[model samples]
Target: MGTSTAYGGPGGGTPLVPSWLGSDGDAGGLASPSAPPAGAPTKDPASPATLPPAPPTRLAIPTPADGSRFTAPRSNFTRFAGSGGSDRASLGRAVSGYVSKSSGGARQAAQRMGASRGSGARLLGFLTDVQARGATEALRSLDLEGLAGRPIDEVFMGLADYICPNAGTVDEGIAREAFIETIVDLSTLGVTDLDALSPDQMQTVFELYATHAIEARLCNDIGTKLVTAPTDPLIALRVQSQLRDFIRNGVSDALTAARAETPNLTQDRVHTFVDTIYERAFGILQTLGDAEADQ
Candidate 1:
């Protein structure tokens, strides 16, 4: 599939995801963005959806010492763009290791904060609900077959509530961003209509969402401010792009490995299944990271 640089960001138009993604639902505040009018036109094929950055508040991470901050051991990405040979391998290890560790820490922190459900868990819950009760019964007026008529983005916006519930936390925002990015990636693969999505395509969507969710969660935990941005604007963007691909590749591989054991999912086993995927994904990443470091 061809790639596009049309992703939404800081300077982009209105974000494709919900504006209230991280809102706490205060008395006078909105809990979600207003839906487009009933007859809104299908999304223009020529234009791609743009996703905004995650919420500004970051998950707290201890800063490394200034001297060691940019090295491969820490996964800061400072040396990743220009490195070669063993150096590139070391940088990859750092990226994988840092993401794996931060993902675990973020999960623990979310549990302690009473927001234990992440995007993958939430999405699994939705699937389980659909399984227990048919899609029409589960979603009331929106069956799986009905999705064929709507624009793909509209379907995504409607599904975001279930996939990335309003948690009022950085994690929720990261999850929301990941979900939007997944739609964009799907478009590249010619998945423009919701009803046309095949079984494998749907599985691919979930896989990619899990991949992006893991990477986005780790990046937010690491924080752009903590990682010293390259002085040149273009180099910084390139580094950011490369670093995302590197971390995403590791997570994607991990998920592929775990998918080998995927069972015929039941409502009762949904949570356990999603948890196992995450556990295995991180475990694989950590092992690969260690091997990379030792190389």
Candidate 2:
């Protein structure tokens, strides 16, 4: 039997909506402009109603209480809480389970974002490209506007398809890891609230998530290698150091490229993204060590 990889975090629970998406009027959350300064005067019945809330001028990632930066958790399998197995087979069960537990609001939010016929096709292409290549290339090659306008479900379903192309044959554990990684990546993009985004902007966020997922998975693989190796202590130490450097350099390159490609990228977001990569790398190392010690 294949030994289970303790990917970290308990699996299965309600999907946590990004805090920014909350209805509360916190910074980065919904904006309800001070009820028009204590209602100085009531406007005409319908004199060209005020425009929608302006898109946020700035975005920020939440910081932890300990004053450390936020990093995406190793897994969000709790979103699939109560699912049977912890392995990849459990991933298959979770996938089918989520379809029936669809959130009406999530669906509506997706529809409002544009789940029309033509847009769905474009969304599919964009998702496919992001999965096959990295998010950066997908952004450069795909129709950003079209993909952004598609429904959230369309984008998510596309991701699901990519994760479980052949339910019968795909490795359940691998699929689970990909799904968790994607969630963690999306979380780092600081876009909990979809209303804060335009179609094109949303597409960019998706691309970023996809790219990060790919990177995170690589880090996880490296950590597995480090922990599982039965080599000499000195050689293992050298290998561990090399793997850590590789992850650091890779993250730096990705961030630099992302900033160059999207000038509007916020400093906080970039920092959070960088922290996420390092945190995952280090977290994996820690977990691997713990597991080996127990062995």
Query: Which candidate number would show the highest lDDT if scored against the true structure?
Result: 1
Q: Candidate 2 has which clashing residue pairs, if any?
A: 12-77, 12-78, 12-80, 12-81, 13-78, 13-81, 88-172, 88-173
Candidate 1 lDDT over 1-295, as tens digits, reads 0011222212112121223322121122222467443344446467776444334433334333233222333343434534422255655565564534433332332231112235666665554555555444555634445553566666666787766667455545666777788878877887766445554655677677767665554444332321344556566565656555655665566556655676456656655656566555656666665676667
lDDT of 2 at 255: 43
User: Per-residue error at 179 for model 2, in Å?
Assistant: 3.9
The predictions' CA RMSDs to the true structure, in order, are 15.1, 19.1
Which regions of candidate 2 are displaced past 4 Å?
1-159, 162-164, 167-176, 185-190, 195-222, 225-252, 255-295
| Residue pairs clashing, model 1 | 8-50, 8-51
For residues 53-77, what per-residue lDDT tens digits would candidate 2 score against the true structure? 5444445553322111112221212
What is the Cα-based TM-score of model 1?
0.59
lDDT of 2 at 210: 31
